[model samples]
Target: MVSDPVQQPHVPVLLRPILANVAPVTGTWIDGTFGAGGYTRGLLDAGATRVVGIDQDPLAIEMAQPWAGQYGDRLTIVQDNFANLDTVAGENCPEGVDGIVLDLGVSSMQLDLAERGFSFLRDGPLDMRMSQSGPSAADLVNTLEEGPLADILYLYGEERASRRIARAIARERAVEPITTTLRLAKIIEGCLPRAKPGQSHPATRSFQALRIAVNDEYGALAEGLMAAERALKPGGILAVVSFHSIEDRMVKRFFQLRAGGTGNANRYAPQLEEESPAFTQKTRKGIGPDDEELEINPRSRSARLRIGYRTDAPADDIDRAALGMPGAGDRKGRKG
Candidate 1:
């Protein structure tokens, strides 16, 4: 049976950076993550007349639903993946929006819940699906071939010991299909060498990889970014908060490309495309959480905030390939 994870206090990272870049103004905005409605509250208090908050988790929607009456008609909550932002946002706020905020990564609430299976520190089920649908991490670990499994760990989790982990998982599954978070964590820990100084747990990367693969988190982010680009009005602000290196890299590259960077190049005579950049980055570099924020919220340490403006440039030829997304080209995204 499914159960709700205990709600952890969510302290949004890089709040000042987001506030500075977003500058809410007196119009509508989209809180793409809306975990606990922290960002949405900030936007509304900052003078935004309306805010549309979207999340894939129904629990999150339920948690935020009570706040609807508090904000009156100013708040809109839709349960869907942020990647499907185009369809969801279009249906809810067809008038187009002034700003968008994407706080990417697993919510602290999800991690705090041992049963959610997002944290290696806690024992729980192997399910890591954000939407509660699709093949779960358990299914993949128990059923997928070793080669494909290794590739998933390598590509999604960026785990260096992907092959070894895959081999170990395959071996363990043969004895008995790997189930529960602790069992998988133990298997991964066994496959790794002894830690040298202040090393992290061996299961960290595998858990991260499993979670990403189960939810197709990277693919979802790419689709969401593209959708935001489509739904936002020209000159509207778009801010993204990425919690991992992979997600940050995607955001950084997307911003660079949208801000008009060359695709590829040679030494001297570069093969350049004569096209205008779509976005102008508000912050030259990604902004990280400050000492104060890190002290208060340790989870904010790895967070990075990047902001840009929507340009009038065409979405076509914007190099959706760099986003490394799947099913993104399909304009008709899944329902919330």
Candidate 2:
């Protein structure tokens, strides 16, 4: 993997916009997915007296520790998934944070390290665990039944050829267990019809699906959102930069429900509002990276950021059924 930046890479996608929206300068803050501590550094530079950095990847935590020392008690890094942000933050910053920032999806460092098995473009092990301990992609593809396998590809990858791919996987794994990234990528590609000249690689979607399933990315996102809600004080800001449709939709719904408040769909029925809405929408619409940033960081192209301010209400259970988002049970394995 690339060493710590000689300079910042592409300005940490939507940094300026998030700074403007969240205004994280003079209080405790949380950089929930502290990939390389870019956002945390920015927050501290903005005058935040204390910032807690949380990440599932131990490597990220290691990298962030030095920054904590440099910041001299103003910064601390925790090794854990952002889903546990509430507990972690309460322990680290009992006062609660003024702002929380989450930059979702695979980090550049993770994808850049071929040995980590995160990107199909760089063949490595079939493992895709962000924490490097949970089920690997190989484990899922070789062990899951065809039906559930198909569901994972369909739901997480959003691939249309889910059934065909899953069937091919089952057939191949019956002969031998899928073991490596390249092997699985090849199996996914072989299951597809020949691509047209301008079409994308057939394995793209299936690989993505397996990675998401292996890491439970969406599940973590949902839990992290709820945790952030619990960790923030009233008027505290929450900012998220999502990379895909699934994540973007989840964040959109979460912000809308918390900020807009609950109400009855039927006009004839009596409507009830909580003592206080959980949050207020800070950004009327999700913001994207500017053209200049996109030009330098292609990965920033897919990022969509939404910001919200916590309201004076207690945190509530996330309505997974209503949100159409995955649950922890769903993240443990394949789901079509």
Q: Pick the candidate with the highest TM-score.
A: 1
Each model's C-alpha lDDT?
Answer: 0.79, 0.79
RMSD of each: 6.0, 4.4
Q: Report the lDDT tens digits of candidate 2 across residue range 123-232.
A: 77788888978788888988888888888888888787788888888888889888877888888788777789977678878878888888888888888999999899
Alpha carbon lDDT at 188, candidate 1: 86
TM-score of each: 0.89, 0.88
TM-score, candidate 1, is 0.89
Provide the clashing-pair count of each candidate structure. 0, 4
Candidate 1, 1-336: lDDT as tens digits = 446556556677787778876664668899999877889998898899899999998767876666667998889899888888878877988778889999988888778777777888888888888777788889999999987887777666667777888898999999998879999998888878876787878887788878888887887887788888888888888899998888888888777767887664223333447567778875669898888898999878889889989889876433445543322122232111
Residue pairs with clashing backbones, model 1: none
Model 2: ten consecutive residues of lowest lDDT: 327-336
